[model samples]
Target: MNRRTVVVGTLVVAGAVLAGGAYLYNANQAEQAVAIANENAAVLIRPNSPIIGPEDARVTIVEFLDPACEACRAFYPVVKSILEESPEDVRLVVRYAPFHDGSEEAVGILEAARAQGLYVPVMEAIFAAQPQWAAHGSPNMDLAWSAAEEVGLDVERARIDMRSPAMVALLNQDLADIEQLQIGQTPTFFINGQPLTEYNFERLDEQVHEALGN
Candidate 1:
């Protein structure tokens, strides 16, 4: 081939290689984006006590909640109703991430309940009676204790468990995980390994159907 023809061929080949490289780079970035999203969306399950839900559910809803947050309290019933209504269709994972002043104690209470295999019941009671305990002023250990007692948790054992080093470490680890995930608010949810911008029954229902391919 002539020199000009050879030069033209070389330029075309170089352009093709560059375009291929860019395409590969973009594809790799997309893959990484998905991986990061999935990681952020994953719940750090506590050891020993597993969350309750169907393993093969179409959607997994992971909630990072604060026991002392009023909004979380309000959202609790909504979530509970959804789970109750469609126990088989959706899996719910609850993670404690206390951000308020009394939140530490609340988390400790939850950990204590988990130790006694009464986490779900105690949590349900706490959320149900949130109006009675959660206040704007100071932490109310007495009210929390009352709620625990009402839920049939061994109050003495729960108090002792609340002071355990293991419980403290668990809360600390959860807080660290929350920070790592950059979670900024209570009641944050992840749907099918994707962080949701907003959470509502309608949205959750829609996402569940999408995930299930229904």
Candidate 2:
């Protein structure tokens, strides 16, 4: 065979090998997802996990998030867009990881707002003002509180509510699940029970679409 034919043959072989590898990896991941879905549903989907979207939606994206995580702040819009685009088909469930120094405080604030029926507004306000308060090295939760209050959260009541044992237990339960899953990242996502092994907008979109069969 000539050099061109030999080169083409080599490329084709390499392509097949890569494709096989990808297929095997996907199969393994799919099995793991199925196991998690069946055996770990109680841990993954507690009643108090914050949710946005329809309960009956076919696709559920569970996000293990830290309010102080810069990456989570960055990806917020990406996840929002996905939900907006697939309003009827996709749902989001947020579980706090609170990995940062002040993140547990932020989580408490969020739960307080939730108790007062201001969860979404307060969360958006806090997220919008994240940089002001979510200092990686030395966070000031006072700023986060101010942001929440600006969005109609009753600061005094929220403070009292945030200190409640119910809220503390809620955060602890989420942390327990995070530990059980061995999730080490702030914005880890699971789509339709499948852990997103790759983190990127395109990969996230692809996984959601694959689950939707779209």
What TM-score goes with each of the models?
A: 0.74, 0.81
| Tens digit of per-residue lDDT, candidate 2, span 15-80 | 442333222226676577567655776677889788899999999999998888776776676677
Evaluate all candidate structures by whole-model CA lDDT and list the values in order.
Answer: 0.67, 0.79
Worst 10 contiguous positions by lDDT, candidate 1: 16-25
After superposition on all C-alphas, the RMSD of every candidate to the true structure, in Å, is 18.0, 10.7
The top-ranked prediction according to TM-score is 2
Model 2 clash pairs are none
Model 1 ranges off by over 4 Å: 1-36, 39-50
The Cα error of candidate 2 at residue 54, in Å, is 1.1
Q: Which candidate tops lDDT?
A: 2
What lDDT would candidate 1 get against the real structure? 0.67
